[model samples]
Target chain A: MSTLSEPPKQSFHMGMLLNDTRYRGYTFQFIALLALVALFGWMVSNAVANLAALGQDINFGFLSDQAGYDINQQIIPYESTDTHMRAAFVGVLNTLLVAVLGCILATIVGVVVGVLRLSNNWLIARLMSVYVEIFRNVPVLIWILIVFNVMANALPSPSTFRGDDATASMLLGAFAFTNSGVYLPLPLWLEGSIVVVGVFVVSLIAIWALRRYARHLLYSEGRVIPTLPIGLALFVVPTLLAFFIMGRPIALEYPEMGRFNFQNGIQVRGSFIALWLALSLYTGAFIAENVRGAIQAVSKGQTEAAASLGLRPGRIMSLVVLPQALRVMIPPNISQYLNLTKNSSLAAAVGYMDITGTLGGVTLNQTGRSFEAILLLMAFYLAISLAISGIMNLYNNSVKLKER
Target chain B: MKNSLLLGAIAVTGMVAGAATADTLQEVKDRGVLNCGISTGLVGFASQNANGDWQGFDVAICQAVAAAIFGDANAVEYNPVTNQVRFEILNSGEIDMLSRNTTWTFSRDVDLKLDFLGVNYYDGQGFLIPTELGVSSAKELDGAKVCIQKGTTTELNVADFFRVNNIEYEPVPISTASEAQQAYLAGTCQVYTTDASGLAATRASFEDPSAHVILPEIISKEPLGPLVRHGDDDWGDVVRWSLNALIAAEELGITSANVDDLAAAPTDNPEINRLLGTEGTLGEMLGLPADWGVNVIKANGNYGEIFEKFIGENTPIGLARGLNAQWTDGGLLYAPPFR
Candidate 1:
């Protein structure tokens, strides 16, 4: 190693912004930052001038005004006399509902397809490949259209299910499927429903405790006790006993067929069904690939080692393969969930009253406040995407590998 | 990095603000093309033909304005816009005039600061339903599933109508007119509601047009016209009179065939002579040639001829001239005398 005894005499020069080693990065960054500011300032000034010329402003006062329109699918109470902001809130709720539902469904479908594709059964594996290929290659928009069309056309209209001797009948005499929507028996919460739910939750905790006790017995005592049956008993007995003791607090209101449609039940619009199903199926194909790759990434040696230690194949998979593969799979899976959430904005195509369909679309048109509406819309999407990633990141950290 | 990104955005916005700003008329003259905004594919209003040319009732207005300005009907470029972006596209100077079938509401005209030239079509909100449903009148439409195009006046109108009548209805709001039509036909909604003219235009394209019947109740008035951005009086006058010239031509019985001949020689009637540019300097006041009236009429005949050619009873749209006829004929179409 050469010992540097003395430093060269340094002089500040104007060229240091580009050529000097020590101060160059800061100088260059400053210059770049200045250029960017100038560019951005120029564009904003231009937009303001343009808006002024057009005799408009970027005001957002329209949110408090009465929204003269009505929304078909609103989770919250809304009327035509409600403010535009309330209408938008309803839209936000609808968007969240569909996004959450789509994510859950997409994950389930993706994992199933992924595992089945790697199955030893040749026919099942080939079928899974075909399903993935067909869904992965087609555009999500076309899939939405196709699914929406099927829901609208293939289903029988309510008039066909009207009479007593009607050709069309409700599923299980409780659910009605029509071109308008899928109607199901509405669940009514009674006086003791809360107690029932509490008992069920307690039963879940009891099952977890029972499993721990089983592990303790295995460690402390030489005799092994079968835990599955005991855990099942712990899971069901308390919930069932509480439900009966509470006199079956939850009652279902079955749908009654009317002249035009089924009444006295909850209805899910066909648009919602189509959008939900299409988003799940389309995103599932991509996630299937992710899951398959993650599983394959786990080495054969680990499974073989578990087998040599007298572990069953199922035990080896649950204890060794899944735990490792899940760590590799989680990060990509979070992104797929985010993708499904964002793609739910396409609900406008099928007339689902999501946030985009209501606020970004109808309200923007009605109010003619495109600048403010669009800015708010972009902010909403960014917030939602960031929030989702933030949550997933927290979950990911918990499941991450801990190296000693 | 974040600061740089923010600065970059500001710089881009500032650049856009510094973009070319000039008199729209002079810009049009310099560019030698009239940037006309139109709908993408509304059947009889603005759609591309097999020959790949934009032709419809709305397209004729654009061509007439271009003819009056440049003395060439073909000196116009069509920009297809959706309902959500039409106003921004016009306000941004991307288009010179919007000849799309936009309604002239009080808010749109005064609040949005747009100058509506003249009403080209007088329409009202109406309901179209499949005849198999056995519903005759709109009053019987309680608990109905209605399909409507979002971002339109019809959405609010239907809601008001239903509420005032103490009825409950579910609205399935689609984004595009085509989607609404598909939803209606596929029995997703029992009733499809829109402007009477739009219903005609949509029904005319159906495979079985007779299967649907339009309900009798007319809910709201929708006077659709061509418009331009406010604060440009010169450009506004040019577009307004170009439309007026068509109406006046129809009123005075001066068609495309007779406009040139009548402009060549003085006419017996003073109004016809003045309209044909043989009696006054009307065209000069709006910054056009002496033969502006003649060019406009010759570009797309008279308003009557355009109406007959596009949405008239003779066409597939098969619409009768109800409120669009002349004032003397007990219709609402009245043009100020070109003195």
Candidate 2:
């Protein structure tokens, strides 16, 4: 009887009038949205007016025009006469190449250092700690400069390194290091090698599927298989078979020493190598800290419980710790990847012929289209960053812990 | 509230009036200084000395402009800009004029809306290779790794030269001249390509200058000059004619040593008298004093004097005035009549 009466008494007060306090919150939110929209609209209008005053039009039609420039160290086929759009495509591909390579190398280095820092050996742990602290504290720009300068100044001239029978010299034959750049052997592919590559890729996919199936079998039936040896066999068998079947199609093209320098081999300019190494090492140091923090966040009790169940130390780590820690590690790691991609624009400083170096620097100066060029550069960076974040979010969702 | 609104309206009107009356010349005069943009550490062009004083061929031009405007050459602020940022700095109105070694191109003049004053240096793209290459000409540099500075015409010229010659070459592009030099020295590239003057400057800084040889090939013409923004025709004329005065003074043999004497007494040539402010109102036409040209010549000795002091055969650059010689000497450098 008291509960029923209390309900009616509360309803009577609720029906008295409309609430002004709740409406005030909605009014404030509406004002904030309007202010933000107005600010953006005003900015757009100002930009249009300024461009008009300067007799410049904001259009992307120039993207289809000839680039009329050459880029060094291209992984894809590009010529000086290619369209500007195509040139930017090449830049995007190069940027992805560096970012992906840097991410892989950084992850390996970070994991090793992170694990070593917690090792039982004091010397090893302290060494890794020192490395992390030193690299993380220094600005990446200084490291890039130091690496580039030392590589340029301390390397040998090609003339000194060139010889047919050159051995036991400062560097290998047809190879030299200098403050300017580095010369290395470039691989020349023989004809009909695509078949072998296709076979190799297919074999890799088969091996991956097999491993997954084996893991599933182990989980359901409590029966374990030797996955490592089987996977190795699966990889080697197909690759070796394809090589023999295709008559061994790939060949190495060693740099030949000419009169003044090496010729006919790919050369990695010192700037590219130095910048790539600096970005990787600096970002790796921060990644090491993130990895260590993530691993430590996993509860000790989980590991102990696994140990009580008679599981091996490696198995305990693989089954209990890593899966949990990866959830924590991935978000920060994604940020590092984005940072590496964005920081690649610093290639402009060293003249690596990246997008920023070509379109933003030379193309802008040569064409005098600053507004268009800068806008394109900004869009490129933003798209790359957003793509990386989107992929990382998908991975995060896949690995997230589920609870009932 | 009404009173405060009235006060705000009055303040807004006052601010608009103030802006409407603001002229660039008056602003610069009131500031008592002129901002000049220059390149970073080019040996004969623009470089700072050990005592931090900026001095070079381009620095002399900046000084003359300041002298023409303020009557005091020291009333100038030097802003060092890199090749990548020079134009942007000028476009943003961060500097009054860009006296850097910028190439005058149709795109820059029309598309960028910049007014190029006049050519200061007539340069050409060339190749520098180690002497041991035994390559006598650029035609033999097939399959060579050529180090090129990015953001310059050198990159385009390299590709065109190789393409037209039907030769295949690998390009090793870099950003700064110093980087290109370092790469060429390091054996990262078989050849370094840039302006002939830049090649000479880089070679002069090397310990073994004799080890390298500049290839005898002029691939493309690079007429380097100073530039100012568009929309300010008055300012543009002042800068353009100031450069013209220096060149004309060189042609007339009117240098700093004899500028005063010439200014005091009339010359037999009518054009000389007008140039020296003794006859016509050439300076007055540009809204300057009658003796503005004389002041400019007095400030920096003449184009010839400035060139000899900085990059002549006696200097480390040791550049011969081959194509840069006066029109009378069969070179391309020619100034219009002062009148």
Candidate 3:
């Protein structure tokens, strides 16, 4: 004790770890981290011991084995003779396909419905409300089942289109809708098809350039250009001209009745349609609510200020409020997209060979590698979710309030 | 304090190790109920009746096992498992054994570490299609969508047969038999393939059974039976012999009606005497009551009786025993001696 003037020279003591304010936080944090690490270690060791006792070891060698199964929709050419790794890749592609399609459709439908929900028309607003409430409140699994069952039962079998007195017929003698799937005429890429495709791509770029140029002209010299009609003409005329110049090289291969069913065309399997439509409709409702809330969150002052600026109602919404509301809408929108992506696992109910259906399903069952399969499945989803959040967060940072 | 923390971890490890080595039989006895996995629905094999009580060829095995373990046939928690989850359920110990129509395979038995008790039903894969398809042979099914139940040997067999025959068929894999039936009936698929027995059962459940025909293509040998997890040889023996007792009971002419009387005293037949636990201490060797076989027989009768009651030629399923008959009757069922 040195007269208590310098706190006894602040001597280090074991008790100080808990009693002293300066070290307490670090001490507690170290203890918590130790407990967490120990817990994880215990869990992992317990699992390993139990698995060994059951005469199983964690092995992912099954991925190299033959899949020996068929997938309904394959973006890549996959035979039953392909390896399980290839099968999983096909599953990943299918999962991505539905997620991408669902996100696009849901965004479009959600924005429209969300806008309509705030409309002055009582009937339209109420109808939009009814749509959101009915769809969002119900579980997505039931929707998937409903869509799959309706498609399977309500649609006629291809056999019905066989006889002279056919009960069902193809649509416009081109698209065939049956219980199995919808078939559309596939475009045959001929020698000059590339030229036609190139011309279309060029016309699309031209339209985009024209819009930018019109914006520039409007800003630099207050000249109004009817870019919509010009852009439309640019979209169609050049492509049509190139097609005729290339002698209409793209021919259509119509699906005709083969020995068993309609063959030789693009058969959009019913499983894909059921899963895609169900996910889109279900996730669209939640997105609609998000959009409506986000749009409303934009201060009434902003809308009034735009109106006072002599801008039209549509112009005020598009130019002033929506861009600002988007800042509020993005985080929840990311969550909805993630939900749609993950909910696509319900594809198994309808036998759509998404990642869950293949890797977590047939492959897991066949290989009897539940632990390894589930571990991989979780890792894949984690990676995907992190990537989605990372990208969306970057976009969020870009669109949010910035320092001047 | 550190000692206490270390002790807690040790205790948890001990608990996990203890669970791994836990005797399935003793667990079932302590719980007073046997968890038995069966198919979601295969009419004559494992489907439920109108009264919500399970009555089928497969359900009888569950009941018999429960009877052997608890002496009450009703002491069974029936777990309806899909093809995708049957092996997993068995391995997870959620069920003592899977009585579902699972085919015994090399990878499943060796790699997956399952113990197939014995072949309960000898079957072969076949296709069932509508009678109006105007096609008779399975070989003629080209470019057709085939509705198949996924996660079974049947899944692989279909792919194999199609490849070998140089045919192109689209596989529409569904999960449960009920779903497959719905898809097949709704015209989503031109062909539905599974065990011939399963096909008969599915057809019989149909409102118009006459509208379907089983194609004459027996693609693969499907030796479906009850199975347990590997390891725990003692419990494995109990389940294995439980199945064998039913099979042997049929061969020894032990009907459920006469089982009790025959079990009361030693019979002239030594095999029957040993089986009924009147002569030997085999039941004690299996860690059970000496009269377990008698309980099993009284629960579901013999194998033939169960077959007749559920899926025999007399039933709506109308399946003849075929290769499932006793060895004396020139079929494949040959149970090991009770001794």
Candidate 2 chain B worst ten-residue window by lDDT? B15-24
TM-score: the better of candidates 2 and 3: 3
TM-score of each: 0.91, 0.90, 0.95
- Tell me the tens digit of each residue's lDDT in model 1 across B189-225: 8898989998999998899999989999999999999
Q: Considering summed lDDT, which 10 consecutive residues are worst modelled in model 1 chain A?
A: A1-10
Winner by DockQ between candidate 3 and candidate 2: 3
The stretch of ten residues in a row with the least summed lDDT in candidate 1 chain B is B13-22
Ten residues in sequence with the least summed lDDT for candidate 2 chain A: A9-18
Off by over 4 Å in 3: A1-20, B1-9
Q: Could you tally the backbone clashes for each prediction? A: 19, 8, 0
Q: Which candidate is the best by DockQ?
A: 3
Q: Is the docking of candidate 2 incorrect, acceptable, medium or high quality?
A: medium
Query: How do these models rank on DockQ, best leading?
Result: 3, 2, 1
lDDT for residue B96 in candidate 1, whole number 0-100: 94
Instruction: Give the lDDT of residue B172 in candidate 1.
Output: 88
TM-score of 2: 0.90
